[model samples]
Target: MLKFVKHNLETIAGVEIYPIISLSIFFTAFVLFTVWAMTYSKETLNTVSNLPLNDDESLTEKHNF
Candidate 1:
């Protein structure tokens, strides 16, 4: 398997750079997505993360004591 991979690498002149190029592309996409999410995503999503409530509210009808 190692020999086969070595032979293939030799046959493809620029294949060694492919991994670097792909990683760069992936990083660029991730950054773009993060920026878009931060700047253009829903305000509800942004506020939801910092909601005032820290506990769950019961669904039952409110009772007056």
Candidate 2:
């Protein structure tokens, strides 16, 4: 089954570039996210990290409208 798929893809004109393009896209996104995460504020991180443990009332109070 794998051999059959590989043979079909090999017959295509631009099939080889697909993997390279996909890998580059994934790599770029990973790098951008890493940089963003590294520079993100500690206070915001704390708030987000504790979100699941926070009560609904607390959330409303903290972000009062």
The C-alpha RMSD in Å for every predicted model, in order, reads 8.2, 2.6
Model 2 Cα lDDT, one tens digit per residue, 1-65? 99999899989997889899999999999999999999999987887777778776776577552
For candidate 2, which ten residues in a row score worst on lDDT? 56-65
Clashing pairs in 1: none
User: What is the C-alpha lDDT profile of model 1 across 38-60, one tens digit per residue?
Assistant: 88747556545545443433311
Let me know the TM-score candidate 1 reaches against the reference structure. Answer: 0.50
Task: Tell me the whole-model lDDT of each prediction, alpha carbons only.
Answer: 0.70, 0.86
Among these predictions, the greatest TM-score belongs to 2
Off by over 4 Å in 1: 1-3, 41-65
* Residue pairs whose backbone atoms clash in candidate 2: none
